[model samples]
Target: MEEQVNVPQIFATDPKLFRFLTKVIHDQGLTPGVEWKVCEGSSRGDNFIAVIKQVVHVAEGGTALNLLVKSAPRNAARRDAFGIREQFLNEIDVYEKAIPRLKSLVGFDLPVADLYGATSSHGEETILLADLKELGFCMADRRQGLSKEQCAAVLRALAQLHAASFALREGSPEEFAALAESVREMFWTQPRRHAFEPFMRNANKETLRLIREYYGSADCDNEYSRAFRQISDLGYDFLANIVTKVPENKKVLLHGDCWTNNLLFKTNDDGFVSAKLLDFQLARISAPMIDLIFFLFTSTKPKNVGNYLEEFLRVYYEEFERRLKTAGFTAAKLYPESELLADWIACVPYGLVVAGILAPALYCPDECLPNLESVKENSREAFVNEYGKVMRANTPESKEHLGQLVKLCVEREWLRILN
Candidate 1:
């Protein structure tokens, strides 16, 4: 005899949502007595994510299913104020449309979450997905950073992702164009960009202060300092004008926010076996180096990046070329290693700026996170105030991370490009 499990109270609270879940379960040919319990997710994500453990009773036995439910904040004002509705739509588009196209074009499943269903209306949206944890996939610790093998696995996965886009562009140009047109650059949108400008300016100020404090006044005007100062002075304008600009020639669908938290790794006794990308809300058509640099600077440890930078680039490029060739395209004619390296060099400042803004939030304790409720009530002022609190809370770690990043940039003569 099978032990009976009671329905969780969490699922009982929303009859409408429960009905949707019931339908989804039924559509999969599972028996109906579905019960769910809430699980934990990221604190910093714009939307609310609830990992629900669902138990379904069939004729022979009862099986447990873990489903990830992501929903827009209930407050409509907050959704509009933060432009979260648009972000949610972008993610929905990627999962519902882009992923299917990629699978058909590339003849394989891309490394992303399997979506069960999604709903969007006006300011509200909800998505249900298979919880990756059920498949032994877990997030790498953002604070600790990734090991070399883990980093390699991520690069390889990213290579495959990028190659799929290239193949799509070659095989079905119109379809690829339509897919690109469907998604917008989250950071470049007017409302979100306005909200982000103040944070960028503040981050620049804090970064400059850290540089001077660490390097001393005597060294403050050195090559690195000069380059940092130039960008800091330019601040948000630099971001708007240069960093976010898309090169016409080498655009690909980017994972936009390619940090550690956005990635999940499954490891076995030997090592990291596979990885999956999450958070497509920021996905956009852009230079592939944007994703590459974002991942390199914000996710991996400074030591690993310093030690294996060239090797990592090689792994990504080689895998990218191999995939492109497998997809019946000449890798050399389409995207050579030389061009890739050049694009990376050109995008170093973009990586630095992103790391500066992301480090504080990534390092801050959960208790130190901004009160989004306040932002919902008073968007701009509340957000800026909370941003300051977060930045102050994580200053020490942010400084250390920024210092290493700046040092790496200077050593590689990446600062010379500023001249």
Candidate 2:
């Protein structure tokens, strides 16, 4: 039997927490005497990541270091607060298991802080990690989505990470399974299913309503219209398909949550490439294509839809094929590259619904928060003007491609609304 992993134990208890952080720094060749300061302008919540400023006490001079002090939200009134303690602990497992493996691929690609277990003076669990600001880093603002350069860097990093896993599984199945087991629940659990159900229902309703208002009765017979009306029902099916229908043997690690906000970017002085990545909290074992489609559709404008996406997937497959060959893993016949376009079509609708629901939340200003009243006033024309390509709606190619994607999901028996 595979080792029975205990999630809770992975987190350090109160008394042992400080020592863990100190030990992590020491192991990394930094001195033990360190100063800690919380990062400014961070959001607070139950189980939210807290940032801290740290300085290692050096013999010659203590240089400043920015550290992320990750903590679980301890809010009592929150209904969605179950198992938060386990969540933080799970994050530790993710960092410990994936980071080292990923390091070889990206060569310090991500601007994440060093994570060492730590506890507070009053007996609370904490994690000490790197600070983005200390490295002169800030995440790409979710308002504008990723710039072309940011997309390229992110895609390259993803390709490398995916390649590393392909290499591992191909070379040493035992080792790969062992690591995956440690963090498997990070992605697969349906703990929030109850809360998510209502959210998804509302999303589906809104999608159809929007479609009706925008297109009028003329295109009601269109496949795209039919698909939009049934997106929400498909979400549950998707969840079931990905989580249950797909056999365990076929699964690979996924980012689980691959939205742009979850990603961070580190850029050079002239705003060119440096490194980027963040929010490993949702890392899990799943199909890799989900991550790619999720990022491209939700985080990019329609103008960026085709060629760049094609190139990115090509690069991923190229890397995947190379690694598989190196490890003597010849499953090329099983997962043929020729099937990519078909898979892409199948996956695009999933991206569409996700992107539609998320576009408001990710891009909205605080003043335009998604209150019922605001939503009532927010017309489809405004939404399209803000994010969609007006030209895309008129173009024959865009319509056909977009319509085909929508049609497939509808035929697959997806529900009318999507969350």
Which candidate's lDDT is highest? Answer: 1
Deviation from native of the Cα of residue 325 in model 2, angstroms: 7.2
Give each model's whole-structure lDDT: 0.74, 0.53
Candidate 1: regions farther than 4 A off: 1-7, 43-60, 189-192, 216-223, 234-238, 241-244, 371-380
How do the residues 32-108 of candidate 2 rate in per-residue lDDT, one tens digit apiece?
45444333334311112333334332321575544565654333222122344555555666677666665554333
lDDT of 1 by residue, 1-419 (tens): 95343455665665666667667766777665644556545555322322223333342256665677777666655555566778889989999998888878776678898998887765447788888877899887677778888888888888888989988888888898999899778775565677677767787777777666656653356555567777677556556544457655566788888888788899887764688998888898887888888898888777788889899999999989988888788778777888877788887877888887788766777677766655544454455465466677655666678777888888877666677
Query: What's the lDDT of the predicted structure labeled candidate 1?
Result: 0.74
**What does candidate 1 score on TM?**
0.89
Collision pairs in model 1: none
Report the Cα RMSD per candidate. Answer: 3.8, 10.1
TM-score of each: 0.89, 0.69
